[model samples]
Each structure stands twice: as C-alpha cells, then as structure tokens.
Target: MVAMTAAVGARPARAAPSAARLRAWGRGAVGAVILVAIILQAGAAPFVRGLAAVSVPSVVAALLLTAAATAAAAWRWRILAGRLGLALTWPQAVSAYYRSQFLNTVLPGGVVGDVHRAVSHGRSVSQVAQASRAVVAERTAGQVVQIGLAVMVLVALGMSAYAPAVGIVLLAVVVACAGVVVAAAVSTRARDVVHRELDAVRTAFGTVGTVAKVVVASLVVVAGHVATFVVACLAVGVDAPPQRLAAVALIAVLAASIPFNIGGWGPREGAAAWAFTSAGLGAATGLAASTAFGVLAMIAVAPGAAVAAASAFHRRRATRAAAVEESS
Candidate 1:
C-alpha cells in the first residue's frame, strides 16, 4: 500500500512534463500539415518566384509600415496596461513589442514571443496575472477591431459581388463566437474568467477618450498591415484594384492570426491563395503576393533583432558584475 501511494504521488510529476511534450508535438504536427497543404495546393514555385521580385523600394516601405504598426500596437498596450494599474511607459512598450514581434517571427508555434512578453512583463510588475491579462486584452482588442474592419469592408464592397462565401463564413464565425460565449457562461470556471476579463477590458477601455484612442490605434495598425500587403502584391505584379486587394488583404491578415502556424507561415499562405482565387485571381498570384508580404513583414521586424541583441548584452554585463561583487 505504501509503495502504491508513493508511485501514485510520483506519477503527477512525470505526467506534467509528458503532457507538455505531447502538446508541443501536437502543435508542431499541425503546423507541418498546414505547410504541406499549402505546398501541395500552391506548389513551391510561387514562393521562389516571389522572393526574386522583392525590390529595395518594397523593403523600405515595409520597414516604414512596420514601424508605424508597431508604434500603434505599443501605444495600445500602454493604454491597457495603465488601465490595469500596471506601470508601463510608451518607450518600454515599444521596445518590448518590437522584441516580442521579432521573437514571434523567428520562433516556432508563432506565439512563443507573446508568451515570453507576457511572462517577462508580469514578472517585472510582480503582478504576473494582471500583466498577462493586459497582453491578452491588448491582443484581443486588436483582433476584434481587425475583424470588425474586415466585416465592414466586406459589407461595403457588397459581399455577393466579390465573394458570396465570405458572407457565409462571417455568419458562421459569428455563430461560433456566440456559441463560445454561451458555453463559457454555462461553465463555472470559464464564466468566472470571462467575467473577470470582461471587467478588466471594460476598466481598461471603458472611457470615451480611451476607447477612441484604442480604436484609432487599431485602425492605424490594420491600415499599415494592409498597405504593406498591397505593396507586396504590387511588387509581385498583382494588378488587382486597390479596393479588391484591400478586402483580400484583410482576409489574409485575419487568417494569419490563426495560431496553428510555423513561425507565422501556413494559414496565411493558405488564406491568401483562397482569397485571391475567390476574387477571380489565380491561386499562384495569391501565393506569390502572400509570400512577398511574408518577406516584407520579416524585414519590417528587423529592428527587433537589435533590441534582442542589446537585451542579451545587458544581461551578460549584469551577470558579470554580480559575479565580481560576489567574489570580492
């Protein structure tokens, strides 16, 4: 009996790590499948061709747009953090956001950078939960606003004219979101978290001035992203109308937000292919455009590399100083 109890007690310690490994494996598998599907459907030609089309001008535009978007995103984070009673400055938010974006672009699973950002920020504040919530709230706001803008664009362009399926997809998404809300309401733990987060969101963005600022910032970020996509499309000789391209760009952006991706690949390419094809353009054009956009996006986040390097250097210096003090 004593042996059995000891074995049972030890099981949890081993099980936790095993479960985490399984989850990581599952995510990797999903990402691989997504990449395989894109290659199978679109082939590797478009990616290679798009790379050759990248120009110095396009690279410059991407860098500029990325800076604007990052600044807007950081501002939004600052607003939310302040509302949550966390100490955050614009400069800190901007630097952290850049580092996070760089990490997101280079790391697998697409969200590792966000996870790091939340944990690091939380640790600094000594209110880990609140800090994490702030990140969540900021990202959630951006997504909601992005979706809203997409819907408005689709509606304005008349969904039936460009793509009837988009309207159906939007409806399905709304229903799914409603279902999730209902499910959360029925579950005790989920309901508590939902209510708590909702309260936090309200507190952070409740005021008229704050809400306006957040919405405007979100719009700017979305516009910058869409513009970059447009630039990428132009670079690849995609001659679609600006309005049509904007709509498709929004769809691709929304798709890129899917977490089942390898370093921000997968769904983005898949969605771009689908969106462009549905808009009466060839799938290859979509793939090429998306590929260019991906490259440009990476270029835009290059500043993050410097930020990361500086951070590492500072840490090393601090460690060395601490060692010297200890020895003395």
Candidate 2:
C-alpha cells in the first residue's frame, strides 16, 4: 500500500513535466514552421544578403538605441516592482534587464529569461510571488501598448493603399489574449493567483502619474526598436519612406513579441517578410532587414553575457568566503 501510494503521488509530478515539455516542443515547432515557410517563400539568399549588409556605424547606432530602450524598459520594470513593494534600484534593474535580454535572445521560447528574472529577483527580495506579479504586469502592459502603437502607425501612414493584414492579425490576437485573461480571472482554481495579479495591476494603475510614466517609458522603448529597425533597413539598402518603414517595423516588432519564437528568430523574420511584401517593399528586403536587426540585437545584449559571468564569479567567491568563515 505504501509503495502504491508513493507511485501514485509521483505520477502527477511526472505528468506535469511531460506536459510542460510537450508545450515547449509545440512552441518550438510553430516557430520552426514559420521560419521554414518564410524560407520557402522568399529563398535563402536574402538572409545572406542581410548579414553582409551590417556596417560598423550601423552596429554602433543599434547598440546606442538598444541601450536607451533597455534603460527605459528597466525603469518601467522598476516602477512596477516598486508599486508591488519590491525595491529595485535603476542600476540593478538595468543589469537584470540586460541579463534577461541575453537569455531571451539565446534561449528557446524567448521567455525563459523573464522567468529567471522574476524568480531571481523574487528570491533576492524574499517575495517571489510579488516579483513574478511585477514582471507579468510589466510585460503584459508593454505588449498591449506595443500592439496598439503598431495598429495606429499602420492606419496613420495611409496603409489603405497597401494591405494591412498584419494589423488585422494583431488585433485578433489582442482579442484572443483578452479572452484568455477573462477565463483566467474566472477560473476557480486560479482565483487567488488571479486576484493577486490584479492587485499588482491595480497598484500599477492606481495613479495617473504612474500610468503616464509607464506610457512614456513604453513609448521610448517602442520608438527605440522602430528606429533600430529603420537602421537595419538602411543597412540592407532599403530606402523606403521613413513613415512607411516605421509602420512595417512596428509590425515586425509586434511579431517579435510572439513567445513561440526559437530564441528570437522565426515569427519576426516571417512577419517582416509578409508586411514588407504587403507594402511593396519586396519580401527579400524585409527578410534582410529583419536578419540585420536580429544580429544587432544579439550584439546589443553582449553585455548581458559579461554580467552573467561576473555574477557567477561573485557568487562563487561569496560561497568560498562563507565556507571559510564557518571553518574558522
């Protein structure tokens, strides 16, 4: 009876990991399919062309823009964390953001870095749940604002002359996301968790100043991304109208926000190809631009690698010190 009970208890634990792996595999497969489809549609030469187009000056410019955006994102994260009673200094937040970006860029699913950030920060502050809530609220707000900005740009740029299919798809996605939120809110099992998340959200939006600050920070982050995309476009020799390029870039950015990506590939390149083709910029141009952007992004997060290494070194040193103290 004891052995049977132990086996039964372990069954749920094993099942949970199996289901998690399946979901992760499904996400990776979706990203792979999208990437493969883009390759089939546009051929592989554009990717090669895109990588060869990056210049020293363009990389420098992208690095600066990425830094600015990362700073603003970190500020926004700090605000959310602060509202939730988690003290996060700007420097600390920026370091963490860089680490998070590096992980997101190199890891599958594009969000493992964020999970690490939340859990790490939570442990640091001894409030894992609130830290998680802060990260979730900050990321959710950023995505919603980003999607809204993308739609506005497409419409404002007179996209009636071209297809706005990407914008429509984003809108549908937003609706679907809203439905998921509602379902979670109404879930009996997740009631307490949902309520706690709501409390974080409520605190974040409790003041007009807080709301305005978040919007400004989010806008800066969005603008930096859009500008970096334009730089990528120029590097790839696509001299389209700045206004139209901004719209297309925003759409690509929206697609990059998709969590199904392999590291940071797949959906972004596919969407850029689609949107650029829709706008008569040629699928090749779009793919090349996105490829350059991806390279620049990885370069931009190089500091994160340094941060991770330094952090590990410090941790080891501290552990050694503690062990020595105990021995003495």
- For each candidate, C-alpha RMSD in Å? 6.8, 6.2
Clashing pairs in 1: none
* Candidate 1: Cα lDDT at 324: 100
Tens digit per residue, CA lDDT, model 2, 1-328: 1111112212343343344344545666788788888889789999999899889999999899999999999999999899889999988899999998997788766765676677668778977667767777777778778877776767788786434556565666678658657867789745665565567679877898888889889999999988999899999999788888887898888888887787788989988887898889988999999999999888988899888888889889999999999999
Candidates in order, TM-scores: namely 0.86, 0.87
How many clashes in each candidate? 0, 0
Stretches of model 2 off by over 4 angstroms after superposition: 1-26, 161-187, 319-328
Error (Å) of candidate 1 at residue 195 is 3.3
User: For candidate 1, lDDT tens digit of each residue in 1-328?
Assistant: 1111112212343343344334434555677698788888768999987898799999999999999999999999999899899998787899999998887777555655665566567767876667767777787778778878887888888755545435545675588669659968789876776677679778888899998988999999999999999999999999877888998898888777666666677878888888898889888988999889988998899888898899889889989999999999
- Which is the leading candidate under TM-score? 2
